[model samples]
Target chain A: MSMRRAEKQLARVTGLILLALVLGGCVNATVDEMTYNEPVAGIGESSVVILGRRHKPDYDTEFDFIECIGDHIHSGDPSIEVINEIAFINQFYPWFEPRTAPLQPQTIDQLLQLPPVAARFDEIKLEYMIWIDGNTENTESTGSMSCGIGPGVAGCFGFGTWGTESEYEATIWDFTDKVEVGRVSAQTSGQNYMPAVVVPIPIIAPVQGTACDSLGDQLLEYLSAHH
Target chain B: MLCFTLLAAGCSTKQVVVEGNFPKPLLDPLPITLGVIYPSAFAEHEFFDEAKGRAESDWLVKTGEAQVEFWDILFDGMFDEVVHIRDWETVQRRAAEIDGVLIPAIGDLQYTIPTHTNVKIYEIWMRYEFRLVDIAAIHQQEDGALSFNPDEHLAAWPITAYGKTPTAFLQTDEEAVNLAAVVALRDAGAHFVTSFGATPDIAVWLDGIARREQDAALSSSDDASGPQPIAQSSETSSSVEREPDSGGTL
Candidate 1:
């Protein structure tokens, strides 16, 4: 190979290394978990339903996540019946105004009094109910960068980074025992880099999806664990 | 900055809750049907910032709901019905039934600088006015309604308490205020309870003026023949319409 070609190759490799170094270290993800009650054998025969907290408006946007979690639970234990969200809304929630439809019982007494929710519990022979609520927020941001390949030499434009944090917690409620079974919490946060000259290059992490994945796995383990 | 004056410290508000520390047992079951009138405005202090000229923290409008709660909890068995006066018209109309009214006010307040550093201090002076007015004794206005005369029968008590948090206390300025207020209010409340009943000088006067009337026996009562029906056992709430202020008046 000619020395000119060799030098060009070396320059490209060094530029790539420099670009890698330019991106500062991203934050690591963290998680916390807690289990409240001892596991019992009867959950295997009982059906389950996942309900988003009523107060938060964003829970409506998490239908896909609910389905994803339901799929994972069903895959983990095929016999465990997972109620469909659409069916729940149509058949059960129709009894009350849109505002009053709540699957997660505030109190055992409230559950007994709510005819529609009680009837649905009887219909599905529900055992465990999972209440999910969480939020993803951009907590902090810093640094700006602009880089590009101008002619043969790489030039810079502007570079910057911002942090994104995802936090989710799922609580399992047992109807038979009239108690909270356990809780699974997951959180993921990292900073992503964006550089632009003519075009912008971004390295964004799937923070929300990653949290959902961790929570789903943890919920499976919590439900299936012996004690 | 000229804009940041000594009043600037009064801008911020820190919520402080003083837990009960009353060790005095009820001296006597007075059973006085008392109505609580929380203060309209306690003392307010404008605190200074780092510059000692900028007013960064100020005690603004505060609610006396907590005071009502404290009074009820502290003097639980002492009064027959510890009603919080919400509707002044209604409470005043039924005022004839109440034996006395308790009014609480914050008198004075002072704070030190640099809670994060050395030489931090907090102090509060609280005053309570307990008026045991006899409706029949007070004079009537031109409209024929009974006029409340403060001179009729009133007891005023002033209490001063201090909390000092040195640099070693390891608390923020806001935290120092909270901690200091907690200590001061708790001490003031406990002191009030003791002085209201336990003190011989005050108890003798209070006992002579106020006495709970026992329910007379119904002629057809199953146990009416007995000496008297136990008024203490009666769970019936007072017929007096009790209420609280609508907004944060105190």
Candidate 2:
């Protein structure tokens, strides 16, 4: 082949290789799919209501898991009345003591607008309320090294470490005769981090499902058997 | 040229390990009950306010509906769960159970009829307070506060600026209030949850950490790698272009 032709061929090959490399680097990350087990039986027929809220927008995954558990129970036992609505948790409800601030009529109106399911149920009655704590630890380490220019012929650099912990509480209430009959409380903790990195790539960890399922199951079973 | 090409290829191929660990909620089937209660005057307020005085009550109904929808979307989006109701009495009974029991309160209303214009801007401020009650410990825990300023949220709108019809302004304000409430709830929830415990479910814990790191990174520096970047990416990417560019060299 002529010298000019060979050079052109080499350039074409190099360009193709570069294009492929860049395309290969593209990645799309997503949360792993979760699996759930069937609800345990022997609890019998009962009615239930749950009010829960997550402080963070992304924490909906937790509620989804809880709902899945509720669905399982409803599927297994037809007589069990399960009314789970995040709205009832009253995200607007004040948490401070002395409770001086007047409840917003608008907020009350919003709650009232929800389906009147509570008024119809007679025998079994239950309510669950959840709150996510914010005092968690978080850490991250990132560094980069470039062999050419700027600093030196050969150079290296890196840093990253973060930790945070937050609290969450679930309050269960039983409504019988328009009164609270029972209340159960539970709490859990969580922590996570991203190790050191040289590039600006996204780092996501594999998350294993925790005890939320058991908590949901236990709450349902308790309501079913009791009420 | 060959050496440079080889080096570039190597750099691109080098895999930098990135790992993260956090908490996730467990999935367990359970039966639960839910209830929704509203003041008896809700319907009357809507009909009377709309039919008689300035028709502001229609706006109230719209605002109420929007608020409910907003909460439904917000919770559904965050928890991946749906609130199902078997009956409405459960909600009334629940509300009645706490009838005398004072809890963290929220709600206030103020209306101003402009002297010059025929428009009236009703400012609705919805606040939420959670009295962290530790049932297990049988003691009242810490309390958190969150407030929503709907006026500030809607101040920049064209309708509000130009003094549009009360109906139009009311619609705008209603939308604004709904959005503001969602934000307030999120903040209040975070504040309440954090005050009670330092740890959260594994998935939530990790997510919280990621958010904190992101916030720290953002506050410390304006670099794109900070926490704000993740938020922007997640929020803005919904409208991002997916098609690849195709063109000849200029």
Candidate 3:
């Protein structure tokens, strides 16, 4: 009876500890948007292409983050269509490559003057082109945990934490009108904790996911408003 | 024996072979039949980097197959007709029929990982040297037979390309290295297609070809058709100038 009572107490304590770990990590996020021009009317059938800017030497906008935003926009509104980034890039190979891609809205106009490019552009009927830039990075880390093994017993004991920050900007251009439509940006930061008694339990902060959510919400609203 | 095998496994060198597919470029093929010579050394390129520390492993990267594939796709898209030359003898025999011969070789290659650069990415850099042989000059020898000069080339230029992939997403170092190499190859192809005619020597050679073709047409035309103008397509007539800015922007 004494042994049974001890086992029950251990089970109750483990449940409470797991509950605390589940709710430990926290993140803070903010989103900002600006409109330079309204979306063109009667262009709902065309698709939008979201591309990540990779020209920066030190960092690149993660491809998964771009896909997350694209997915959010499509899921939020079933009518809106999103083209695969790789397909669109490959179809226009060298023209849209890092070295040759146009920098300004006017340069896009020059590209469309080519018959082959113009034909492909018309076939796709691209409504809007969104360029995403930025990255997520670990900002700070502190504390450490150590593990040891001896005589058939191994365990870790300590507390540790780390912080991550994500910043990103999305620029939207109206391909039909050949003009800038608007911009949306999101910034987020979070702290993650790992506390160990016997086994280390990690509570990972959703830093990138939060940023993607904020940016995607704003973009969806902006694109769907006119429709 | 098992202990010895484990020790050997721990010290085994890492090997990576690059492979990728490239799409055909969206542009009008230039109006010229070109001959391309791929040297044997270029077709089987391999780079070996020894580990500088005990913590790192040696690497042997082979990019020969990928190089050949990339060049084949790029040449097919850039020229009207591509004739592969097996050797200089083939070039000598066919020099009169071809507009020019282009020879490409790997100049140098280097790579870095996160462990070495303290950056969270894997990067590869490649230098390519291109030689454009003036077939017209070679075919116009005073003797009936063609003369060859190893030191003579109408244009020789170097192009540099770079590629990098973040280490965060890749699961293994070999995968990261392979990706970086493929990306570098694509960059080189894009640069060449965009800047081929913009090089100074190439521009002069193109002008000479246009003049020669125009003169030949004028001579062959009947008196009634008198001094026929060279028919140049809009795409062919436009001059592609090299961008002054380096690295990508916007």
Residue-level lDDT tens digits of model 1 in B1-250? 5346535535545444443322222234466767665544432222222333233443421325444554556555456666665454545465556655565555555555453233323433344444443322233344433234454344545555443332323565555555445444444554554456654544654664444332242332546556754342222122111221122232
Q: Write the per-residue lDDT of candidate 3 for residues A57-131, one digit (tens) a residue.
A: 988888899899999998987677888888888999888777787766668988887788999998988888999
Give interface RMSD for all predictions: 23.5, 16.1, 1.0
List candidate 1 stretches off by more than 4 Å: A1-27, A40-42, A54-61, A94-108, A114-116, A143-157, A225-227, B1-250
Off by over 4 Å in 2: A1-45, A53-81, A86-159, A164-166, A177-187, A196-211, A224-227, B1-178, B181-250
| lDDT for each residue of candidate 2 in B39-148, tens digit (9 for 90 to 100) | 22221122112212322222232233333343343333333333322233332233212111112223332222232224332222234322211111111112311112
How far residue A172's Cα lies from its native spot in candidate 3, in Å, is 1.0
Give per-residue lDDT, candidate 3, residue A211: 94
Better of 1 and 2 by TM-score: 1
- Per-candidate TM-scores read 0.38, 0.28, 0.83
Q: Tell me how far the alpha carbon of residue B187 in candidate 3 is from the true structure, in angstroms, after superposition.
A: 1.0
> Whose TM-score is greatest here?
3
- Name the best candidate (by lDDT): 3
Question: What value does the lDDT take at residue B172 in candidate 2?
Answer: 45
Note the DockQ of each predicted structure.
0.01, 0.01, 0.59
lDDT of 1 at B111: 53
